[model samples]
Target: MPPETPANFWGDMPEEEYYTSQGVKNTQSYFETPNGKLFTQSFLPLNQTVKATVYMTHGYGSDTGWLFQKICINFATWGYAVFAADLLGHGRSDGLRCYLGDMETIAGSSLSFFLHIRNSEPYKTLPAFLFGESMGGATAMLMYFQSPPDAWTGLIFSAPLFVMPENMKPSKVRLFMYGMLFGIADTWAAMPDNKMVGKAIKDPEKLKIIASNPRRYTGKPRVGTMRELARVCQYIQDSFEKVTAPFLTVHGTSDGVTCPTSSKLLYEKAASEDKCLKIYDGMYHSLIQGEPDENANLVLKDMREWIDERVERYGSKNL
Candidate 1:
């Protein structure tokens, strides 16, 4: 309720200036989807030829801003155009704060925007990659399942939530009790808070910065959110064989938020001919943003190399 001490994510610098300093052109806009008015941002290489387009999705309680932009900028600087949207109910998007009652509708909303951009001129023929981090990985997977065949050339996941660890799974009894309320408590922020940020970020300084995000949700999980995630994780696990796109899934062995078994499961079950998995020995869940510089860069380097190789193999001649 009080004034936020930090004016922006990166020191006192203006947003556009800071993005320019990072060697990427930044643009923010509101996208009107049938489900909600979504806050979206695009990061493009300043003067470099675009190699491909990367559509990104941030995790639960997170948005496309904050350190998430670091990933976007990194992709853009590597000659890719990156675009991201704040998932509904989080960040500047329209909805009850931090509530996710319907996972399909939420995934659909973001998918619409990504499809629009991917189908437009100068990009339609070019290779497009769908990238997701944390719970955003689940959203991205849903989007992929709902999309037309071949809609995305490839998929990249960082510490995705395709599998929920035993400790993090919501109690069935609790959900049943809440269900007795006839769905009235669906939007309530009453689910157990697993103190996920504490387990997801390894670097203490970076953790502080992530916690300072004004738009980040810092409340207990919503009833429907946990319920839907549990349900959807099972659904995605069952549908793993449906994945046919070239893909790379990465996880941290020490990640307490999402299980490293997530990546392993996907790699084993997916039908994709070209699938890769990377499990970092001691990295935390937020591989790209919460890790120390050398570590984050290490993850980023792997991501860049993976995407670059795919681009060369399947990329288009278009800008």
Candidate 2:
């Protein structure tokens, strides 16, 4: 079982915590991509005079609603027009949950939506930023590296998965042995020894809040998800030098899933001129909730400040 009592992530969002009007203002609607497939959730502010707009992409096996409603509302309060959408396999989107069909499909749809929003009238020249967490962070990096220069004003990554924890590093000889005996060792080799499952957050209240929501925990990972993760990790490792956008990366020192050292290595390796890395002490993988929310909030506030500075210096004409 996946831990009977973990910390509450959303803080009392026990089932039926539907999107509230105060934060998410019922502007949620779906729009079609060039490929003729309709994705879900294009939320705009009821009051559209926000200084900037933030387009967020969610992680694997996760949807836009519930998971990001709190974050979205917080950003909206900070004078941002936020738009968040469920990725291919998750939520109401048309795809298999917890699986990867085509990585390009996921990345392309996001790029298309971003372009559509950027080209629209009011938001046309606004300073826009991309914020992602965990798997979403990985996707945001991929999208940033692949897009043209100035695609985003800046990027805020919360515990990006540049690499899985070092403990998961199997001996090459062991992998060879498994391959020889099994013909082909499955990529879905279960990490029974990996204690990352329920260890993501350290607080009990936050875990309860997260668990109470159904969209947060839906299905188990597929072989395809693992394969895609490997591919993206490899891509990031190989092309860290290709990244040019300003980046603000945050991770927890006590993270059980993606190691904090991974963020260190990524920060050291990226070629961006402006980069900041903040590691929260005693923080688990999920920094948004759990104890030490203050530290994470400071980090996010600093991210917005950094983004504002970059926008002022670089300006929308450049980004």
Maximum-lDDT candidate: 1
Lowest lDDT block of 10, candidate 2: 183-192
The candidate that achieves the highest TM-score relative to the unseen native structure: 1
lDDT of 1 by residue, 257-314 (tens): 9999889999999999999999999999999889989999999999999999999999
Candidate 1: C-alpha RMSD after superposition: 1.6
Residue-by-residue lDDT tens digits, candidate 2, 1-319: 6844322343455423333445345355566765434355554445555677787877655567654556666677666777777776666665555555357677677767776786676776788788888788888777776677676777888888878665654445554555565634344443234434467767776665655656554444544456567677777888878766778888988887787876787789888898888887788877764445676577668766776676677655432
Candidate 1, TM-score vs. the true structure? 0.97
- Per-model C-alpha lDDT, please? 0.92, 0.67
As a whole number from 0 to 100, the lDDT of residue 16 in candidate 2 is 32
State the local distance difference test value for candidate 2: 0.67
- Give the count of colliding residue pairs in each prediction: 0, 12
Model 1: lDDT of residue 278: 92
TM-score of each: 0.97, 0.81
